[model samples]
Structures are given as structure tokens and as C-alpha cells.
Target: MPKVIDHDQRRKEVVDVTWQLIVEGGIEAATMREIASRAGFANGALKHYFSGKDQIIKGAYERSLNNLGDRLAAHTAGKRGIEALEMFMRFTLPIDQEDATAARVLLSFWERCAFSPEIHGGYDEHLDSWKAGYLQYLAEGRADGDVLTPTPDEQLVDEIIMLNIGATVVRVVSPDHLNAHVLEAQVTDFIARLRRAE
Candidate 1:
């Protein structure tokens, strides 16, 4: 037999290398040649996996979003209402090295989204998904009487999503200003302000 390859695994490996490059040195560093070399593939081999660097970048970004979604799903499983929502938000905070790396990679992609319509479209889809998730959680909290901000459902959903994204970006850029405790406190206060008065 010649050689069997797990195409999905190979593509993921390439994407991992691309993410490493971006996390270490921004999107500009993730050239196809560098990605192939770092991924232990010939230059031409990367083309077989991805048409070009842009495709690789997009793949890496989508991978990041998928990873985040997986983690959030894990955290939110078997939980509902405010507890699940809080858990999901906590996972997004960049308190540790792994989260910081994720935040950096995501921020780097945000810049690319400005110019790449493909990336922008993917980002829009990812963002829309997040907003929808938030809406679900918000509705759950309302049903359970855990949320009482009196804000419009759509408005609350948008605010929550914006707050999480803004905090992630700020934590990535100035972690010292938003330490783990600070992040927790910020979220806690935000959530508390949504509670109905006794």
C-alpha cells in the first residue's frame, strides 16, 4: 500500500501550525511556506491542503471558533439559566496562558476581517451564532426569574455579547488591568445588575 493519510487530521495540523504562527507573530507571520515547514510538510503539500495562505488563515480562524464553541459547550452542559451563561462567559476570559493565546489569535483575526471579505463573512457568522446563544441563555434566565434587567430581550443579548468581546480584547491587550479576579468581578457585577430586586 502507498500511504494512507487522514485528510481531516492533516488539515487540522496545518491549521494548528498557522494558529501558532499567528499567536506568536500575528497573521502576517503565517505564510504558507512557514506553515508547511512548521507543520513538517513540503511547500507544495500545503497547497494540496489549502489553496493558499488566505484559506489557511480562514481555516485557523474557524478552528479557533470551533474550539471555543466546544469548550463553551462542555462548560454549559447539564447546566441552564444564569449558571450556564456565567460559565460560558468565564470561559471566554483570558486569565491563563491558553485563554490569552486564544484571545491574541482572535484579535489578530479581527484585523484581517477588516480587509478579507471571506474572513469578515465567517466572523459575522460566528458572531451571529454567539448572539443567538446569548439570546437563548437570556430567555432561559428570564423564564427562571433570574434575570430582571427589564431591557429588551434583543438589546440584552447584544449587550452581553458586546461586553464579552470587549472584555476579551481588553484582557488580551492589557491583562494587568483586567486580572482574573477583576474579570470575574466585572462579570459578576454585570450579571447582578440584571437580577430583579427582592
Candidate 2:
């Protein structure tokens, strides 16, 4: 019998390798040849899994978003109110290697979005999903009387999103100015300000 291949697994392996390359050296580093070589596949073999570099990058981008979703779920599970909001905010900070990698990779994709329509569309959707998730958590806090932000829901959500993005950029580009503790404290302080007096 001829050897059987797991196509989905191979594709995931390729995406993983590509993501690592992006994390280490930005999106430009994730070329088809490099991905195939690093993924232990022949150059032509990668074409079987992905039509080209664009497809591979898209796959890797979605994988990173999915990862963010999973981490948020894990952190926010069995929690609500300010606790859940804080947990979700932690996902935006460079609290560890995983969060740092995701933020860096996302930054790279955002740059690419200016040039690639495919990346632009996918990134917009991914961003919408994140915004929706944050809104849900914030709404929960408000319903529980913990989030006392007087701003409209949409504006409050936008401010939170901007804060997280700003924090990620500062930490990723100028590490000396921000550390995990500082990031966590910033989030905690923000949530504290949102609390309503009993």
C-alpha cells in the first residue's frame, strides 16, 4: 500500500512553522521555500497543502486568532464581572511569550493588510470578532453593576480596544518601558476605575 498522508495535519504543521518564522522575523520571513524546508516537506509538497504564500499566511493568521480566542476562553471561564474583564484584557497584554508572539504576528499582519486585500478582509473579520468578545465581557460587567463607565457601549468598547492595542505596541516596540507587571497593573487599574460604588 502507498503511504497515507494526513492532509489537515500537514497543513497545520506548515502553518505552525510559518507562524514561528513570522514571529521570529516578521511576515516577510515566511516564504514558501522556507516554510516547506522548516516543515520538513519538499518545496513542491507545500503547494499541495497551500496554493502559495498568501494562502499559508492566511491560514497562519487565522490560527493565531483562534489561539487568542482559546486563551481568552480559558482565562475567562467560570468568571464574570470585573474578573472576566481583567482576564480578557490580559490576553491583549504581552504577559508572556504566547501573548507577545500573537501581538507581534498581528502587528505584522496589520502592516500586510494595507497591501493585500485577502489579508485586509480576514483581518477585519478577526478584529470584529475580538471587539465582539470584549463587548460581551464588558456588557456582563455592566449588567452586574461592576462596570460603571458612563460612555455609550460602543464608545466604551472602542476605548478599551484602543487601550489594549496601544499597550501592545508600546511593549513590543519598546520593551524597556513596559513589563508584565506594569501591563497587569495598568489593566487592573482600568478595571478598578470602572467599578460602581455599592
Per-candidate clash tally: 0, 0
What are the lDDT figures for the candidates, one per model? Answer: 0.82, 0.80
Candidate achieving the largest lDDT = 1
- lDDT tens string, model 2, 1-198? 999999999999998998999988988898878988999998688878887777788888888878887888898889986688788887767778778778777777777778888668887876788778778877888888788867666776687788777877876788788788887787877777777442
User: Total backbone clashes of model 1?
Assistant: 0
Best by TM-score: 1
**Which 10-residue window of candidate 2 scores lowest in summed lDDT?**
189-198
Q: Candidate 1 lDDT, tens digit per residue, 69-178? A: 79888989999888888887788777667888888788888888888886688888878887788788888998998988877878877777787778778877777777
| Residue pairs with backbone atoms closer than 3 Å in model 2 (clashes) | none
